[model samples]
Target: MDYRMFKHRMVNIVERMKAIGGNVSEVMIGAPASLQQIEACEIKLGFQIPESFKKVLLEFSSSCNLRWVFPDEYQLAGELDGIFSGMLHWDLALLKELNDDKNGWVKEVFSNPDDEYDKVWHQTLAFYEVGNGDYIAFDLVDNSTDACVIYLSHDDGEGHGYKLADNFIDFLEKWARIAFVGGEDWQWLLFTSNAQSGLLPDSQSAKLFRSLLKLSI
Candidate 1:
């Protein structure tokens, strides 16, 4: 999408999310990094990320500092579709650190999402397992509005457990950290693709969300 169109949509979404108690500190339409930045990052990581994914880094960069605005609260409802398909979440402090041209920390944080893309919980959980031993999962959710949602499952046979993040950054940080680890037995999943399910209540879902929010902070 063009920057102008993207920015307008983002403003509308952010306002709506805020109405529902979402905490969105900053919004970016295109990749926050430049080409030279990405090249330097690739060298630091010792591998290349998918071009499709890199397109994201080339296009948009977003930061949702949930803690700053919410203090200790996080949204509970999960949206229907994937809001952060290409973007990655970076904390404000981290953003500055990574964005610094001298250190080139931003280049280093860019990572490939793993293959286990199936498991997620709108306003709850999401995961991915790259290969080797790298893995990431959303243990909880902080935001639940039109801007973003999550759907995840527990390993238990009953599918009785799941969680979501209040904002995209929360979700990204959870998974991104794991992807950065890179492992062989990494048997988890994380995805930024087209989400399949629509919004659904988890039966006592509000209670679960409130509980998770308290835990997230």
Candidate 2:
């Protein structure tokens, strides 16, 4: 929990929201997740959680929003939320819902499951939702242990969507550098591609994506 970074940056964002006539909350740094709760989630995920991510849940707020009160404006810059948008609401119920939901989404997206097999839903530690059915998750299937942050579009699997960052903290820091706008699904694509693909400059998702693409090919 990089409390130092939040001191000036998040507080400033709250001030910005207030200046914009947005109804803001009281810097809602919600309660940290109990070890029991995290362990329960890990049991459901079928993978050990990343230590960095686990730390965020354990020491800091498990899930919270540091943004505007309304949904529309929140869509642009989002809340004081650490960029997960609605998906940041990684509540026990939501976590259960996503983890339990294996086949329902598969059935909808993969029209011919038997004929088409790239992996619409790779084993993922989805920490955020992209509004649509896609997710910003850790690639539980490939790099589950350390895991770079990757985008999981509904129709595309491992080989497709971009890998956003090398790790959890990097993801937040980079987005914070970009004012959380780059955290948006589209903004990520636009900047990374325009940079000839590495918005974080050291992002390894590109190499991982290439390797995954080979398997799919």
Best by lDDT: 2
Give the CA lDDT, 0 to 100, for residue 110 in model 2. Answer: 47
Model 2: colliding residue pairs: 66-79, 66-80, 66-81, 67-79, 67-80
Model 1 C-alpha lDDT per residue in residues 1-217, reported as the tens digit of each score: 2445434434544554455565555654333667677666656544443343344456664222111133234432453111221122332223323323312211233222232432222222222321222222333233322223233222321222223333344434333322211111111112221232211222243235324433221
Local lDDT at 168 for model 1? 42
Q: What is the lDDT of residue 162 in candidate 1?
A: 26
* Each prediction's whole-model lDDT (CA): 0.32, 0.54
Candidate with maximal TM-score: 2
RMSD of 2: 9.8
TM-score of each: 0.33, 0.67
> Candidate 2 on 72-139: residue-level lDDT in tens?
45433232232222112344436656655533555666446344343635455677755566666665
TM-score of 1: 0.33
